[model samples]
Target chain A: MLCSDSDLPAPPQEALDALCLRGARLLSGPVWAAAEVALAAPVVEAVALQGGRIEVFLRTPAAPDEALCGVLEDSADLEAALNVLWSGIDAILPEDTARTADATRRGP
Target chain B: MGDLDRLNSKLAKLKGKDDGQIRASATDSIVSALLTEIEETILPREMILTNESGNRFVLVVAGRRLLALSGHGAEEEGSEGREDAAARIIAVFRGPFRTFLDNAREISIDAARPPNRIDPTMIGCSVETLTAALVGPGQASVADPVAAACDLAVAGLRLVGGDVVGRSGDAAHLARLEQFAGVGGAGLGQLAGDDTDAPCCVFLSDAGREDAILARIAFRGAAALILAPPEARAELIALCREPIPAAG
Candidate 1:
């Protein structure tokens, strides 16, 4: 039940559920099952006991010397974990920023 | 040199480095690309979680380990539990080729004894795979990637210089990479033999230099493995919120 971007009608709960389930059934059964077990609301809340919210200040995008605390006061736990998982990518930024910046000075 | 000349040099240099009925095969540029990948993918740069549709998702992570994620998405628009985002996220973490090249994500594990929500099997499998693929007899951490690069550089050096250390080298640099893994005494015969169908020269090039720099690896005629500058590793891990206890 795929819909074109321009004419996307409000999909029903069951159809949306089916669409989501179909998106991930191919990876592995156990992985889906395990995640389904943990992704339950109660299970997701249990993460708070294990270290709910990690403090990720803004050092990479702005001044590292004076890092700013992030604002995630109202977001859910699973979303937080997913956010941090992507954050590790910052570890591998190229060391040649100055050189590239110099090269970019001549760009149109 | 011209691109064609460089291409021929690359082709001449690459004999059995790419294709064969062998256990493994890799080239210096491919290795360079790996380093570039490690550099671009391993660390955190921002605390914001931007999704694929250019929207933002919000959350904070603490140790049991806390880091930031960028460009993560939920399959159907919704919250955590009801949504299968966790399943999708796990699949991405445990997915193929460093979690799919376009959407690479990190996997969580407990090298030391604290636990997190991720399935134990996922960590175990990734550890075993990373160990068998690159790490030798040690836990996977910063050292695993550093060792992989040095191993490639070392093997490349042996091919072009006819010796592991070549003619000139920095003893400190060689010792440092050697400490990361058991990548010592990798001989030329291990990669290619004159009597075999795979006969060619392969070189291990350092990141910014036209020739090898650290350990002065392969200065005689070709480049071999050597430690990248300590600063590169330092800068890479600088962004992680919690210190990864030194990899053994």
Candidate 2:
């Protein structure tokens, strides 16, 4: 769903989930599926992890440096594997930024 | 000269030294040349990513591995049992290009693992098909072969010049392009031949002088290719994220 133009920092994961669920109720399997997958890796985190659910809280918006939020359960046994995956994610981020920025300036 | 034009020249010069159809086996030189130019010249300094949109997706990638991360829609699962999920992800993005790769005109494979080894099977369909598949269906496709060529030209032109730029058959060919708005002084040049017909070129502004001129020829459409500078790559990627219409 399109966000309002209030310049709000992306709300915490919990809040985002609420919004996503509220707008497109869970009965809609496709929308629910997309949200579930999208939440796994984030450029930023609005929600802190609690027992089983993640707590959503708005973070201070980054001005110059943007943060990505990835949602992996704190319960995973593969901390080492998760760390490596994060490293790969971090590695390509700069590339992604540059490419996206370049595309924007060139304007197709 | 505009940033785009300069890279074009470098790519052309890079390819000049390579003799094709039968060169001693080594890393695919053209792939290496393109990747190197992108890493060294186009990514050193830039904000590369922006938050223009609330969401974030990869803006660029450098590794030879075509990376993928897949799992279930809601339930977390191990890689062992997610083949279906992986297939679904690829199905959404991959298009006609799969056919092209299955039946490529050329297939170069390297059994030995070297740093720059490329699986010939990875080559997508024609450049056009690959671009469209990656960008998305219904999204307008722009063929900036000139920019792609420019990247090669910048590397090639920088490494080798003179005789290579002059010859028509295998050497190189330079061609001029019509003027456009912000792209005023810019033009395109190409280097091509029968055996290794990799098209390469440069985009140059009127104010910019060629580092080396090609000997005049019939100019049967040989545009230049060179490496794109960092800033230009960032700019180009950003433009790619425009919101797609619901229909598209």
Candidate 3:
């Protein structure tokens, strides 16, 4: 399934578009897929190609963790990859949200 | 009576209490007594109190004389509340008796000390005592360099990319380390000669040589690179996106 920009939360539109464009270009071969997960601090972009290779990038922070990139040879591997990325993103979002909330309350 | 005697008498009510309770009571007593003295002597002036931890408490005294200190009559709107300032002062106090005495002495001697006099050695001084002497009871606090750097790195770094490579132990098992060694613009040869074991290095350079420079550092075991030029960010991200070669 193709991922839409609306799938992500409140990230900068420009960054989300750029991330999706890059993902599409990189995964243009056989089965291309892209997902953007909106997060308070940084939006997460996950791109997967037919060979099961996936690249994840964090939008605002711009950090990339390529350790998870590998060929997804089967459905089980795809499920495991999705679980790992979603779990990692879920874990980081709460802390980021709390920090953003705290900063807002403290004022500039 | 001497200032110490006055402070001691004021704090006498805190005697016969446990150490923690004594300290707590002493700080409250000292802050109240000091603020009262400041109101009487200094009149209506704006002042800030800072503790060793770099916390600041501001007091805006309202009155004609206080306004005259700042060459104005209208009360300064939005001055920091007195209760918050007092609480901050109490939080950093070490020993109630010593801190109160020292704070009192500083207030009493503020006009006598030379404006150009360097601060006395703070080698065994608590943060509250040091700050009390330096800032006095009704003075503004100065910025602390270390704290400022920490705030900048923590808060300001949001615009810059947060951790590009996962920190120390995120799968790469890279050690958490930071070091400033070698001058900028050094060739790969100099970097190789210096400590390659440092997990991160920031290079000062124009964007043109980034690709070659980045590849060289990656080969030299630098897990992360922070380029100085803003234009280098995209190139750096692209470099990071490249797949790691298979281990032979």
Candidate 4:
């Protein structure tokens, strides 16, 4: 469930689980079947994998020469992957309003 | 399995105890005492204070967490002594209190500014009876002291009535931790620049668990704690006051 724009409580663990499940559905066939939880402070996101392949990529796909392909695989290995995505998004693009856009594009 | 079970157990415990098991007043006294101890023992600096709707606040350095000082005042008491009490409390923050003071600068900005919109120093929630209130009416005995302190800091932030704020680097949280840690400004800035280890720092506010969660992310560490109940905060601060060497 989406946290309301107003006040919110800690994301219920169930909600986090549901988020993971939803993320798993977005990737194509033969994708890794599980989700790993990651935290980005007030927000939490998941990283999806298929076999050994990591699915995260930058929103502004760089030209072959201009792109900065950060280490997405180990970006947030210990915690959730969405948090890592958010931080990268924030650093590359500090616009606060783009949080949802960044989160949606990079979701599992 | 143990980690999974622990997570499950913690989630299960969150099910009940929703009567807002926090005694607003009791929490206030404890936070007040902890700040008193910090002033008396740690860093003694002068304080700038203001009050609105019965809550009180003291401004510190530019980037430090706004310290909230509370006390159980005598209702039957007259105003003549209240000023003196305020003076004593202000005095508590004075004298050789360290660089937390040196970093002070007048931003000349109102408390309503964008970042200050979520005032870091304000104890956003009531602390009076947090112990009796949070641990469930029947299970106060089982309240984990560490959890309770973290609860108090979060509660303090919320009580002051601010939005839940979090970011890659929470400027105020970083500033306050630096000041509280007594690290020089340049040194503290450099430490913040070092993203090698998970950062950890305690927050004191009137907000609730949300703030604690924010602190946890802000200070990514194995044991990131946010203490709210004054007694709980005191214990955590005591631990923080320990000598973990920079070399070790």
Which stretches of model 3 miss by more than 4 angstroms?
A1-108, B1-79, B86-202, B207-224, B227-248
Residue-level lDDT tens digits of model 2 in A39-92: 221212222222222222111112214332333232222223333443444343
Best by lDDT: 3
For each candidate, the alpha-carbon lDDT, in order, equals 0.28, 0.27, 0.29, 0.28
lDDT of 4 at A71: 23
Model 1: lDDT of residue B91: 34
Which has the greatest DockQ? 4
Using TM-score as the measure, name the better of candidate 2 and candidate 3.
Answer: 2
- Note the DockQ of each predicted structure: 0.01, 0.01, 0.01, 0.03
lDDT for each residue of candidate 1 in B1-248, tens digit (9 for 90 to 100):
74324433433333223232121112322222322322333222222322233444322122221221223343322233533333333333323222222231211111122233433222111222322333224324323332333443322223243334432235544444343213322332222113321111211112122322222122213333343342332222211111122333
Q: How much is B66 displaced in model 1, in angstroms? A: 7.5
Candidate 4, which CAPRI tier? incorrect
lDDT (Cα, tens digit) per residue for candidate 3, span A58-105:
222212322122222211233345445544643444465646645665
- lDDT string for model 2 (B1-248, tens) is 64334433433333233343122111122233323333343221211211122221111222322222221222232232545533332442242222222222332211112234334443212222323444444334223332333333323221122223421112222221111111211111111221222222111111111132121111113323222332342222222122112221
- Which residue pairs in candidate 3 collide? A9-A38, A52-A72, B44-B66
Deviation from native of the Cα of residue A18 in model 3, angstroms: 45
For model 4, residues A52-98, the per-residue Cα lDDT tens digits are: 12333222322111111222221123223433544565455435435
Residues B45-152 of candidate 3 have per-residue lDDT tens digits of 344433333433333333211111111111232133523333323333323323434443222211222223322321222223433443333222112211222121
Superposition error at A53 for model 4 (Å):
35
